[model samples]
Target: MPATTIHFVRHGQVYNPEHVLYERLPGFHLSERGVRMAQATAQFVAENPATQSLAAIYSSPLDRTKETADIVCQAVNQARRVRQEKPLSVQFDQRLIEAGNNFRGKRIGRGDGALWRDGNWRLLTNLMKPSWGESYRSIASRMTDFTYEQVARYPGQQILVVSHESPIWTLRHLLETGRPEHNMFLRHAALASITSITFDSSTQKVLGITYADPAGGVQ
Candidate 1:
């Protein structure tokens, strides 16, 4: 835990640009829309100025997160007029995996048995503890701890953390100002969306969620 600004950015959209549920399926790359989204993320962070001062970048081992981190690093680097090699070394933190999905091996779509018009369908109830997957409590606790620990390593600072949707949303559920359990289904940390949090290093109590999706415009 540290008195630092933790910027948690969700990974870019997956190759499943069709908006299907993509989980546990490893090696999915950024789709064309995802690439453009990532670039928009880069430009937003680059032009924002406040985000150009990150000291370290950490990400999930997932390809989507890694790709997003790379582009963000370049944008921030270019913004700061940096002239050094390896401006930022991105580190992978596994605690950032997406909320375990039961539909991992299947192609999720309208025709798929798992795909649902309403995310809260009875089949998907208690998504955290999906009969097919992991618990919300587990994901939330681990991710919050990981984020707090990392923030401590760099106090009073800003760090970029590229992670998956569920993990990021879980963290948000724990730190955000809204209803506590809204994250189980409706929490949408879109592609390249950012959620910021701060907590006391000693007590580990979340001070608050400072800013979220500060630059993610429509869609």
Candidate 2:
């Protein structure tokens, strides 16, 4: 059995001037530069011979992720000669969504930390388990399950998934170290970055992992 690869793509920058911790808040779409970044990432992936065999594209239901997935699928279809009636067909999965945060609408700037000021200081007790919102272990479990399901369904083909930084990073940490705990301050996935995981088709075990920021130098 041949190995399968899945590319987890983090969405581009949001149009949040206030620097709000958007979290899973609705209506937070991509910014103008973000659109360009998504297009550039699509072009980079499409033109690369390694990703030419991508069979399916999946995305989170959020606006930013959907937009990014659309751009990527369009470019991939054009490059690979796969025709679709719509702009690009993408399957949305809730498991690929951003990590749920208790401070969704709050700004991340100074001011005694919104959560603490809001009397949510109790929620900060466990940073390792991340008592503020969804735990890292939960995020890792959901994402890993989704990835394994896709790997089983599409054996040797490459698959692309548009997701958020938290989930992707958490999943990456879990896969890399076989542990769910990680330092949230350390950023693993960048905006519009690609984290590729290759799995053995027979055992569904991870064979290798790679990271790339196709739109890193764009700005």
Candidate 3:
């Protein structure tokens, strides 16, 4: 069977000086180092034979993710131009958006106006299922839906996805463990990392999963 691979990338660091939970918030673009991180990943993808000819690019419609996607797209398209291949644009997908959170605009862990302060501490009832905001199942569901569609659309090919940490890791957790619930603090999807999952085109079964941290050394 032909195989299809999806490269899911978590966006780079955001320019959040306030350190508030910028979950699904506006005006959170990439920091300078974040741009460098994205550029590193972009160069890796453009030069890597396995991913240089990506079929499509999808991104969450958020400032940080879009910025990262834009940088990668530029590099990939420039490389494609050298080979006379048609350039691809970043396609925004709502399913790839950041997981919803109840702590938007609030800082967590200690100090004044923390998320745990006031009555918000009640939301910490469950960590596995993440009672604080959107459930892991929901995040995995949306990401899986998008993945399956792309798998069918670009059978035997590869694609790039720029999204937030929770959605990317949640889907991987579900695929690997047969469950979406996990410890939030133990996620492995680092900033600007790529989690590539290959699927059997006809069966949609995961054939293999690999991870690369091209921008890991940027920080």
Candidate 4:
């Protein structure tokens, strides 16, 4: 038995001039800068020796994630050869979708456009459990289950999962410290960032975790 690694990648920035929450919203594709960012991330992963052994790629079904996954799969196919003769294909996983939010299509801010102005006090009453959207525990549970499943299915290999910011960060926090409480303001998961998890192939136990911003400083 050999060790396995999984990389959780957050999608690039979207072309939202209004800065809408866009939670699970459709048709929100990547911006121009985002395209460059995704390409840079794919190239970074392709050139990195550690990720050369990636065997499979998985992504959320959202347009942004699908676009990023396509670019990454192409780069990995051209740069590295997996055990299979064909290039690694991108698979869709609903569990990797963005966290549900009631604030979708709304401009989120402390100004007048905020949710509070509309008298939606119920949504803001509980920040600990996050009354606005899906609970952190739910995201963590789903992501953890998906990760362990992939590890078990692909022992001795590496896999890449392209996902949204909330799910990626929540899963990272849970796997890293065994806590699911997440603070949106304290997020470290940059757009197009990669969070790596290492697992013991024999026991399917989590060994360690790491983080990287492949598109950093590439604005």
Please give the lDDT score at residue 114 for candidate 4: 67
RMSD of each: 4.0, 2.4, 1.1, 2.2
> What does candidate 1's lDDT look like per residue over 30-49, in tens digits?
87767777778777766765
In model 4, which runs have C-alpha deviations exceeding 4 angstroms?
81-85, 109-114
lDDT of 2 by residue, 1-219 (tens): 699999999888889987878888888999998988898889988888777568789999999999999989889878766444333479999999999888777776667545446766667787788888998989999998999999899898899999998899898898888888788888678889999999998899999999999999776
Q: lDDT of candidate 3 vs native?
A: 0.93
Summing lDDT over every window of 10 consecutive residues in candidate 2, give the lowest-scoring window: 79-88
Question: Per-candidate TM vs. native?
Answer: 0.80, 0.92, 0.97, 0.92
Q: What's the CA error at residue 116 for candidate 4, in Å? A: 3.7
Q: Against the unseen true structure, what C-alpha lDDT does each candidate score?
A: 0.71, 0.87, 0.93, 0.87
* Local error of candidate 2 at residue 212 (angstroms): 0.8
Question: Whose lDDT is higher: candidate 2's or candidate 3's?
Answer: 3
- Looking at model 4, report the run of 10 residues with the lowest lDDT sum: 79-88
| Residue 177 Cα positional deviation in candidate 1, in Å, after optimal superposition | 7.2
* Regions more than 4 Å wrong, model 2: 82-88, 110-116
